[model samples]
Target chain A: MKHSLSSLLLAAVLPVALVACAPSEAGTTTDGGLSGKLTLTGSSTIAPLALEIAKRFEERHPDVRIDVQTGGSSRGISDARSGLADIGMASRRLKDGEIELTAHAIAQDGVCMILHASNVVASLTDDQVRAIYLGEIENWSEVGGEDAPITVVNKAAGRATLEVFTKHFGLDEKEIQADVIVGDNEQGIKTVAGNPDSIGYVSIGTAEYSAGSDVAIKLLPANGITASTASVGSGSFPIGRPLNLVTFGEVSKLQRAYIDFCRSAEVHDLVTGLYFVPVRTAQ
Target chain B: MKVKSTDRILVWSLRAASATAGSLVLLILCFLVLESVEGITRVGAGRFLNDPGWHPSQGAESEFSLVPMIAATIASTIGAILLAGPVGVLAAVFCRFYAPPKLARAFRSIVELLAGIPSVVYGFWGLVTLVPLVRELAPPGASLLAGILVLAMMIVPTVALLAFAALKNVPPGHLEGATALGLSRWTTIVKVVFPSAASGLGVAIVLGTMRAIGETMAVLMVCGNITKVPSSLFDPVRTLTANIALELGYATQEHRAVLFVSGLALMIMIVLLVFVQERLQRRARLA
Candidate 1:
């Protein structure tokens, strides 16, 4: 019995050992000269675009593997600084404290206020938006809409959108009296689309896509600047933030290739398809 | 002599396994306590019970008050239990006493199947279906009531299966005695069967409450996740579990430690609940 058990164990371990001993094919410059693994973590806003770019990059160089994860922009900065991620996706420009990391802008996305299509309110001034979020203006009629209580949908803490929105409106995060808190752009859009009385802010690209797809949501202009990819491209949108891939200190050959590919004209169609303006066009 | 030696080996191995299981719980408790110390001390233990609201990232305005979230968790768990407990127990009774044997087996299987469904699916269905339904009755469909309804649905099978087992365990002699005394079937079930199975029923409810309280996804999806003390059933609230889940992805230092504190709070609450259950069972036996 002991002999049989030992033989069974040997059989299980032999293949694993053989596989481990085999020469690694990942980093060998045999297929298209670029190969290895990279992990990009950060903003949900840039994740879809990065995923698409990674897919195209992988097809061109089969041995390259890119893993994309979304938490929020803060996580992106921290992960990059901590060396937990090869690249970090931040939807906003780096703050002064984050200068240790280098940022490469791949695309531009604007944050826009979204409401259900049935909402009568067409636009809101900065002060009006601030007042609504601060709970001073409770009813829609107070802001040129119907006589119903306005449902304020705010993003959760750590989300870049929430930080950008709060900073733009000069409203303190603590003071915003929100009725619902959503995590991602799609969830925010869905919440507003589902409720006629609700208002939320999300990525311009996601909102426009959802609206065009008949999701019953409309994007409200921010501070008289139209909330569209065109305005963002022209540098006219006030609430726009750069879609950045950040890295700390030195970059490896694989990392440089992937980052350059993300910024190149080759992936411009993927960026536009996702409703985001390419960095080259914006510049 | 050889068979006796093998029996002794099996007994010792079982003892070791049981000891390991028991010690693992203690180790987890110790780890949670150690990890939560920095957060609890920084935020001050008193603030956890009395602070106004949760605003962990706002610099000086950062308040790590866990009051509202604890209230939300307790309210939702109690509400879910109230809604699910009677329904589940009655369903079990019907299956045990009224339904034909084959039908009872089929019904039990369906209930067990309900238990098998993932909590995330329930959350999705509640968000898509129940949220809209609640919106018709009340504006801003995601509310505490929606969470309760979703939690109740998710824990029903747990309660029903446990209650069914409890009902099945009632001694047959007591039922025969009740029938011999000329009592009606319903009367006998209420007086003899229920009294005899009271302790087991208590355990069923306690286990169901445990499941309801520990649930995060379905409740998080439907509960609107607003950190406030709810004034009405329609008001939105955030639970302790949801707070940790929403923030843990990006939390660092103090923020991350506070999440551990939340975990400790949840563990302590569950332990207290188990203690209460033990006491109740003991008292029921004494009576």
Candidate 2:
């Protein structure tokens, strides 16, 4: 019996030891062949688009595998810098201090204010939007709606959407009195749709796409610039940012191919399908 | 000789398994403490526990305050216990004594199924059905009340099942003695059976509390993840568990450390609750 137990224990330990002893290399380069694994991480907003493009890329390069992970844009930048991932997908443009890495413009998206469709208020000036977020404009009637109190639905901290919004509006994140803090664009839309007196901001593409369907929400224009693909294309929207794929130092061959594929016109439909404005234009 | 050796091996293996489990808990506790020391030092432990705001940002000032989140967690848990405890205990009592055998069997199976259902499904149900219903009844549908309502429903099976088992364990002779004394059926159950099974019922409440406090997804779905000191049941608030769950995915060094601190705090809270329950049980046993 003791022998059997000892043998059983040995069996478990043997496999784990074997696994530990095995080669850890994920990619092998042989004689100018381009076949390896490429990992993309960061930006939940950019993940869906990346996944769609990765599926197509996998189909084309059958030998290559693309692993896509989403946390947020910050994770992307950090992971790329730390050599954890081949490419980092960031929804917002790189800042001045992020000079160590090179950013490839993969897509563009507009962050726009959103409210329930029942809200009569169609447009908000830059100051008015700031005031609403700052909790100065507390009532809907103050902004051309009914007599109900306005519930401010703001994004949680560290999300690229929240960063872009605060940067554009020139409001400190700490100062904005959020009544309900949502995590993602979809949550923002859902929260606003459920609460008639609530107003929030989210990705224009996502809001528009959802609004087109059954989602009872509408995009409120920012400073007279309607948040649309056309507005983003024309550079008329103030709240727009480039969705970038950042790589640290030199890009590998496979990384270069994947980035090029992402920026190519072939992925425009996919980019648009995710509600992000496609950066590639037909020549 | 072979059979004796085999028996010895089985006993040793079982002991080893138990020791591994015990050590694993100790290992986790040590790891959490070691990981959170930097964060606790950066933000003093008092401020971390007592402060009313939490803003852990990158390249920005971070204020790690769990006051509001603690308040929200406690309120929601207490509300769930208050709402679910009596109903569950009464239902278990009814099943044990009042209900017909067929009806009781059906009820038990239904409860077992409820216990088996995943928490995410419950959250989705709350999000889709309860949120909409609450919207009509109260403005801003996803509030503390909605979270409480959902948590209570989720915990009812846990409390009921445990309480039922406790009630069933009441010695049959105790019930027979009450009947022999000519006490009413209701009086006997209320007086004799309940006191005998007090420890089991206490365990049921403690387990129910733990479940409600530790729950993340369902509460996250229903509770408005607002950073505020909730004034009313209708007000939206974020719990400690929800904060950790929502932010852990994207958290960096300092932010991640603060979340770890929250985790450590939650573990300590659970341990303390267990310790207190043990003490109370001991006192009850002595009395």
Lowest-scoring 10 consecutive residues by lDDT in candidate 2 chain A?
A24-33
Q: What shift in Å separates residue A58 of candidate 2 from its native position after superposition?
A: 2.9
Q: Which stretches of candidate 2 lie over 4 Å from their true place?
A: A1-31, A281-283, B1-23, B50-52, B58-60, B132-138, B276-287
Give DockQ per model, in order. 0.31, 0.43
Task: Give the poorly placed runs of model 1, Cα more than 4 Å off.
Answer: A1-36, A59-65, A281-283, B1-30, B276-287
- Clashing pairs for predicted structure model 2, backbone only: A1-B6, A43-A72
**Candidate 2 interface RMS:** 3.5
Docking class of 1: acceptable
Q: Per-residue lDDT of A43-118 in model 1, one digit per residue for the tens?
A: 8788989999999999998888888998778888988999888899999999998999999999998999999999
Report the number of the highest-TM-score candidate. Answer: 2
Chain A of candidate 2 compared with the true chain A, TM-score: 0.89
